[model samples]
Target: MQEYTQEQINQAESRGIEISTDVKEQLFEYANLIGEKEKVRALVRNLADAVSQADSEGVEDLLDDARMDIQELPDPTIGKLELRDYGYMEEDMVPLRKEAALDYHRMGSKIYRLGSAGSKGEYASKEMIQAHDGLFGMESQMWERIKDNNLDYAEENLGAFQEPMSVIEQEEALKLYDAGADIYLITNFSSPMYVTERMEIERGPEHYQMSMTELERFRNLEWEMQKYPQIQSLKEANLLLGTRRTFGIYQIRDD
Candidate 1:
């Protein structure tokens, strides 16, 4: 039997095969996310030279911090943050328990970018899912990664964009859900609004006067630099995750 030729691949794509295993594999490896360890490491090693040169320029940590600051959640592999506080509040209610607050964060965000039909919204329009075959094997790969991290329910076409959860907690959350619990999906990369978590305690009463905009470095970074180098590199030289949505789960369920 003949292997699928490049022409066959192109034809399949045009007719809406919608994905190339090669591309997905590349993305998988590129994300440093999941799959065979050797392949993932190989992808990193391929980019290692370029990554090193980028690092050597003395701008590594800046980029790394930028990633940390932007990512909705953090990863176990990436280490811990200097400060983090996830909370939930009603119109006039005091904050709830930390776990509850975290759940609110998770559930609320997932409700926003819900892609109708089995986690297919993120990659394309609603029509695409209706027209195409399964998410290929993409969703499986996505869910597997989330499962490894202990996340639940998402068909996971791509991966998670952790803006806040530590990788450890994420793994635990997945495990908790898999042990038999319903779950929800949150699109970290595209949220309607970013919940600004203020560390009121860290600054003390005096610092209360300052808004997020008052913080110079953060202000400069957020407003002025859309693609500044300060947000482009990493310091530890370990690894960077692929999609931040690896933590996502189902958007809604029926009884």
Candidate 2:
């Protein structure tokens, strides 16, 4: 992100404009922000690195570290001033839960059919009922994780701005989900919105304050700075932040 400073300096130099002291101070402040951004990125990278070598407990500790970095990020957009009072409604989250439950039920049905090939009878088998029950339980556990962590949902495709989930992360998510892992330990790694939320929170209100065109450029710079990075820019990130979901759940934050 410090490359932004060089880009600015080069433009000013090319225009033959003398850099002012105030401008220099502003640049220095921005550089400090860049340093904080790099720290968060480094922590995330550490989590990614440890995934290959660390045990489950070790990786979880790193995730805790990464998440703490987000909460401690300077001037987070979501918690800024009046917006901190905002939250999603139950109606908003209910549909997501219902949709996931239906999806799980279908998955269970498919598994039951595939496993019980010889049983063509109309009556439901013990295995079929158990499968549905187990999947429902999984869905419940997944929701508990989301609600407990105050994680956001990605109702729409988040485009390129959201971080891509790795294969290892996917395997871990599925494995944990299938095992009915404790809700608190679920991690809820598959939600693209969670990644989007953490990124914007770390970037802070400067991200929220960008105009559409500026936002596009800023996120593009962010993308280039990272080995990977968003398509919708500011508007979509705000939606993930709970603006679009307002017609539905109450705030998830504790009073």
Candidate 3:
């Protein structure tokens, strides 16, 4: 874990932001988890400065960047392995998988940067789709040409359009289906309704729960956001638009 210098701690304290030892420890752990301990510390300092200056936009931007950094960090153990070794392919096709992964990451990064620049709605969606289609087209052409002798290689190289299946994914899919959830392709992510449904429940106040109608509305809102360019851009940028649900039924339950 990374340790913050006393000077850094003092700087944050001077800004009226209390960085408790526990909080610092948590930040350190999170940074280490993402293999970005130093970057995380720098972000914390930036955040403190932003807060001290009452720069809401700066704070939000810094936080958003930090979130992106964390999200982009591959699991360390997984990061060291080639696609074939990572179980994304059955044959020795590390080069192709690496190239595809790089392209996929580039696409995601480009979309994120655009969103951060305030691109929203239809424009954002179009750009995102264009990027996706461009990559998919290249991969599809390659697959069609070489699929006979390299089926696994071809499939793995397609990236998000098709993910290699695993036991864990199978179980999770089962859980989503059993919970009356629907699946949607959010960019390249296989998002299930139940995940956001649970997020809504947890984010609500104590004993709060959504009714069937309310849940349906919430789900629809998410779907709509994905379809709309501006909303999708804002969502990708992690901006809190006025579309999230905050109210629900109050009930006590013991599980």
Top-lDDT structure, candidate number: 3
Mind giving the per-residue lDDT tens digits that candidate 2 earns over 1-255?
A: 345555555555565545445544544343443244445344434433454454557656755554453344222122111111122211111111223433433322111111111122221233343443221122223444444644344455332333322222333333222322111111333433322222222211111111234334434543453443342433333333322333334467878
Error of 3 at 168 (Å): 25
Q: Weakest 10 consecutive residues, lDDT, candidate 1?
A: 81-90
Candidate 1 lDDT over residue span 1-255, tens digit each: 012223333444464444335443433322332222343334334333334454433333433443343342322121111111111111112212233223333433211112113232233222332344321112333323333544333434224432332122233223323322122233333311222222211111111111222223222433433454444422111112221223423256687
Angstrom error of the Cα, residue 36, model 2: value is 10
lDDT of 3 by residue, 3-49 (tens): 44445657688867865465455455445444333666686787677
Q: Predictions ranked by lDDT, top down? A: 3, 2, 1
Q: Backbone clashes in each candidate structure, one number apiece?
A: 29, 9, 5
TM-score of each: 0.17, 0.17, 0.26
In candidate 3 the C-alpha lDDT for residue 104 amounts to 36
In terms of lDDT, the poorest run of 10 residues in model 3 is: 109-118
Pairs in clash, predicted candidate 2: 88-249, 88-250, 89-248, 89-249, 89-250, 90-249, 160-230, 161-230, 161-231
Candidate 2 local lDDT, residue 54: 40
TM-score rank, highest first?
Answer: 3, 2, 1
Find the candidate with the highest TM-score and give its number: 3
